[model samples]
Target: MTTFPQHSRNFLFTVLALVLPVLLGAATILAKTLTVSPTGKIRSVKEAVRLAQPYDTIWVNAGIYHENEITIDKPLAIIGRQQAVLDARFKKGIFSVMAENVLIAGLTLQNVEESFTKNYAAVRVRGGGHVTVRNNTILNSYYGVYLEQTDSCTVSHNLIRGNAKQESTSGNAIHLWRTDHINIVSNKVSGHRDGIYLETSSNSTITGNISQNNLRYGLHFMFSDNNSYQRNQFMRNGSGIAVMYSRNIIMTDNLFEENWGAAAYGILLKDITDGYIERNIFRQNTTGIYAEGSSRLLLKNNEFRNNGWAVRLLGSSEDLTFEQNNFIGNTFEISTSTNYSSHNTFRANYWSSYTGYDLDKDGTGDVPHKPVKLFSYLLEDIPTSVVLLRSLFIDLLELMEKVAPVLTPENVLDNEPSTRLNVWKS
Candidate 1:
């Protein structure tokens, strides 16, 4: 046995302590790249994932790989070259990710059959953080990209399409449950039950997504709070967008169009409090907005055009402020429930139906605008009376009621109505 002096041993230990971290960092920086190809030694992605270390790169080449339920338990980047397709073969899910900082990009995952007892997704991040699933195409899956108990994850720039006939058999295109700080950006989701469904999720941002032609809602939020939804398009869905049981939300710069059904609206706000619905365009819907049991919501700079009812305020909703909105060519500019004695305030909104003049040359009309028509108030109890719309007797009844101030909710008047349409650049 060779023994060194005490000073020499201490110097060697100090040198090793300095060199070891650099060597380990170099090893981490030089993470190995595993290849998955048709004729390669590592042909399967599951094999690649099994043989990969943390922060390794798995490059899948172009081919149709028949694989399912591929679990990734380590942080890895799975990148596809050319058009790599992972066919689930109508079996289980494609990728079940359980690791943080995982990236799955530029791949096609398809054919995850519907299951009654399970939710199979094309890419599912369970109990993970900072996972990203981007630039992929998900087709015919039960769920496109599912985040369960995930935080700080992103599902962006993906095209998720499903052939959903009924709501019972179909799932959402992008579903988030109990997630926080999620970024769902620039994705196009259609033909699913709901395009994007958030339940019990909070502090998330959903922007620049086009959610159209879904079976149920374009975007559905249930019990989700403190989220931001901006610059999205919700068009031609069965029920449009439904934000329910949530608080402190911000919805701005969205386009809601052509959601025509007897029960459909541009948005249905139920039990929501302390939110902002600003700079949105609601066009050609059955109703632009239907608020029930919502409070303290600021509806500002929104345009409601050519709708059956531009705004339907139920009696249960209170303290909603509608300001600087443009209500143009709607059959009924506003509707309220029978007992509509709420503290809803409407100010500075431009109503095309308003005939009041501004004699003082100010932008605001001198006469206040009463948006709720008598026929609209009557149709709240007798919905079948909508067939009598545009009739002479109904017009006369509305004019008389406007002069006398009868059944329409008096509190839902715009004292400072805008003389011209408000142009918002949001």
Candidate 2:
């Protein structure tokens, strides 16, 4: 062979050195996937986990694995193929992931035993970043998924249901405690104590969830701040949703429907501040939005339809504004203990009960529309007085109150009521 130049030999050696590690790294990334099946070499998932390198995939086939508890301490992707079952033997959680960047996907975890203590979940992320628990089916479990003290995790595309009857014994379906920046999206939860419970968690986004038919509030958040829930549905729960002692919350494009009970409401805003409730539909609720000691809320473009008391402002609430909303077919549009002071302002809403005329050819009415009738306040004190709602005497009393307001709040006025209906295409 002809002798090569010094620079050419140096360049070849450099290229070989750079390309060697790349080939090894590619082989590591494309590492062997361990098959966990009855007939496979690795029969148990726990043994596969012990033998697997970090970032390797453990493909579990369709079979039942009696795993009372599983701890994923390494960054492994444990994916189930075709509904592989992880029966927890009526014990505690099925999987407790304690590693960073772990993924558990497409599994069926079921039959967790009920416990008075130790909230048992199907899957729990204790402390990790970039942990994703997705596309799993959890049935008859105590707690569906729990994220405690975890950060930047995702819990998405999971179907969770529990037949929990007692509140003192059952736990939440998806419970987040002290977890921050968690993205809980596109999950369906039902028949649990609370569908989703957030306590002292912050900077989280819960979007596109359908929570219904739970024993308690469909979604409850307490002492959680800077969180946003959008495009979610909360229907037919014990007390629909309770947001307590939270600040800087945004609730948009949500459906709160058919939450009818003695204490049920579409949403209970208690002691919250600096929040925005926009473009939401509150229909067929006992009370659409009950405000208690809440302040500085911007409620806009929302529709309250056929509710008992559309908005009940408690005596301690202040500085709440209702604007650009449609309040239609509500039994009591606004009810307050004492309307002597204008703690809340109402402006630019379309009320079907408004009898004002637009004489100036403008879209808005010339006179302000008062939503609170005398009957509204009457039903507040005596809820059983609705039997005489359609009688002529009740009509006469409402007409007289509309002509000259005495008992209703004079300050809670929609200054520019729309003469036409504010029909939204939501």
Candidate 3:
């Protein structure tokens, strides 16, 4: 309804001359502080916010504020002093931001009722830029922090926990829709449908976050491009992470472990292209990486340990390179739908099952290494053959398959296989 002039639109940080003695937390550092306390001139947080001007910092003291859908329609900094709690009584949302240059920090928000019709969230930002939500705790929320059409937002150092038992009735911890240039870092999320979800959101960075115990994927990205996921841990989630229909993705130094189920995978890449997945750890998952309809993948220096089917390449994969990696103690090293294809390359990787002799004193083995086993191919055709995994007859068949390459692909061999495991550097 109201818009500033062209010259004043970007002057959000211009200091005003409005003088007020605010509380001590961020008021000591803010331009102006509007104190909200039980015994102060402003008794309620809503009253303080209603009378506060732009660029003013509203400090809510350490107390419980029972508010339903407190909306911020102007540029302001609402910082809670000593982590004040805002209880929505399981009836509505706690905070909603519709303005740019808003900063919400140091608060405990709780209790947003689940509604099939309304996507009730603890904190919802609707079309804003430079919104910073940091160092807060959200509990029992339908959606902890929902950003829609926002840009340049930073959500950092927050803890979000939801009680979501079913996927159809639950929401993500942090959901971004059509947002850009956002940074999500150092957050802990648990017990949600999806811990962090991105849909059509691009140029974002997600780092140093721990997402676990979620009912769905720990981090789900669909149709999002140019995103970076680094230093994150997805443990015991329903299926770890999923990147679908995206390009130019960089995933590095993340840990995907203990995501065990018939349909679970450490990372699922479907229709993804031009991605770099390096230096990550995938352990104890049903499948370390399940790739289908993907191309131009660079997987280097990663570790896949003690998993079932370390990597599964479906029928439509091509142009993938696994270099200088370590595959240790996996039940099945590589499994493919069709005959193992030469479209992917595996060079200088260490496989624990490779019993070759480096007689030349060279670190690389003289003979080529084949990762696909006969039992894996047999299991693919008839899954009931898994019952004979440890049988001596199956061992003989696998040894015979390894002695000769009749059933496997002719060219899917690592010529320079490493005799030693590739060590990780930090």
Best-matching candidate per lDDT: 1
TM-score: which is higher, 1 or 3? 1
Model 2, range 199-228, lDDT digits (tens) per residue? Answer: 999999999999999999999999999999
Query: Each candidate: RMSD to true structure?
Result: 4.7, 5.4, 5.7
lDDT of 1 by residue, 129-181 (tens): 99999999999888999999989999999999999999999999999999999
**Tens digit of per-residue lDDT, candidate 3, span 1-426:** 998887786564343322233343345465578988767888776787799887789988988878878889888898888858888899978888999989999989998989899888988999878999999999999999999999999999999999999999999999999999999999999999999999999999999999999999999999999999999999999877887999999999999999999888899999999989999999999999999999999999999999999998886899999999999999999887755454899999999988887998778989888888878877778889889988999999888887776786666678899999888785
> Clashing residue pairs in candidate 3, if any?
none
Q: Score every model by TM-score.
A: 0.94, 0.91, 0.91
Give the range of the ten consecutive residues with the poorest summed lDDT in model 1: 402-411
User: How many steric overlaps does candidate 1 have?
Assistant: 0
Q: Which residue pairs of candidate 1 clash?
A: none
What is the lDDT for 63 in model 1?
95
